[model samples]
Target: MSVSVGIYSVPLVCEAVPQIGCGCLAKPVLARLEVHPDIAEAWLHHRGDVIAIKWLRELGVDQQVGLLRAALGGDGDSQVALVAAASSSPLLATFPNPSYWYQRETVDQLSQEEAHTIAARLVQRLSQARVPLPDGTALQCDLACALQEVLVVDEAMPIEARLARLLGVARDTFQQHLGSQALSQLDAWLTPAALLPEDAG
Candidate 1:
């Protein structure tokens, strides 16, 4: 039987994007949606209340959504490509642990390259820090995603809903700030400079 979510008849479940407070389709849901016969197009956008059914075709043959966002966020830089590879690679598991080397003369640890890769990914996000979403209001967002998302409402919307949207935006902004700080800490700790310090000062 076909399922319906909110106003759409398509069997789609919207979930919050991790670390960025934006709406994202759950992967399993997307895997199902990808093959749905009724769906002419399915776009897994980083924002929007529902997945953009028309956006899928824009992804083209190389339609891995993560790579698309990585390219966009990094401005098509090679460094972003490297970081994207590491994010998907299981090889990251093999990287040595991070710890103090003062106690031991020699310690096994991640290479500088590996550390940089990790550091880059730690700060990586699926979308820009903030996006304006027209609140039709793009599915229900009780807890919201972890990033900064601004909700724009039609003038006709009720004041209560508008106020609610404003509050949601405020929460998202705060959450984004905390996420940024945490990622920065991770970046500083795992970057090449931290791992292979020439000055050690």
Candidate 2:
């Protein structure tokens, strides 16, 4: 008997980027739709839907499809590359230190150098991926939104201060708000600003 591995296929439904919400586009525009919960979880975790919509605007449905196709773990190479890249990044590296130190007397957790290094790595990966992101205004907006979600989960800052910097909000703010009602709000708040178009820029 022969065995199979390293073979993958995206449902025809995934061929054209699905319009996120309320567009004049007809339903079932693409064919053979199939979605597994695991894929949905991964997409949700990484805010992949938002990322895909933004990319679709420039690259068109075809290119978006290509990226998604390539993203689906061809020969396990693409999956491994994405996983290695995400795991090796510094943001993930420094994420745990602060959590471990929360109750300790030491206020000094992540160093300025550490912060800068992680930020640089994120930027570098974004650059290396060669993805065309939104302009500064749009990027800033998106970051602000993402940061806000992070703060909601961490809930350590004054709401006023929290609103001031959305994307990449300071680590201090994160530590302060780690346990708050904001987290509850997140569960109920379904549509994130992260999913909005960058047309504001």
Predicted structure 1: lDDT: 0.28
User: How high is each candidate's TM-score?
Assistant: 0.20, 0.18
Writing each residue's lDDT as its tens digit, candidate 2 over 86-113 gives 4335433432243321111121122222
**RMSD of model 2, in Å?**
18.7
In candidate 1, what residue range of length 10 has the lowest lDDT sum?
A: 101-110
Query: What's the CA RMSD for each of the models?
Result: 19.7, 18.7
Kindly list the per-residue Cα lDDT of model 1 for residues 1-201, writing each as its tens digit: 343211112222111112211111223233344464544433322211223232323333234334433323432233112123434233223222222110011111111222232223323321123322233122122223211122211133432453355444433433444444444433333322322223433
Alpha carbon lDDT of each predicted model: 0.28, 0.27
Q: How accurate is candidate 2 locally (lDDT)?
A: 0.27
lDDT of 1 at 196: 22
Judge candidate 1 at residue 148 and give its lDDT: 18
Stretches > 4 Å off in candidate 1: 1-25, 54-201
Poorly placed runs, candidate 2 (over 4 Å): 1-116, 136-201
Candidate number of the best TM-score: 1
Clash tally for model 2 = 9
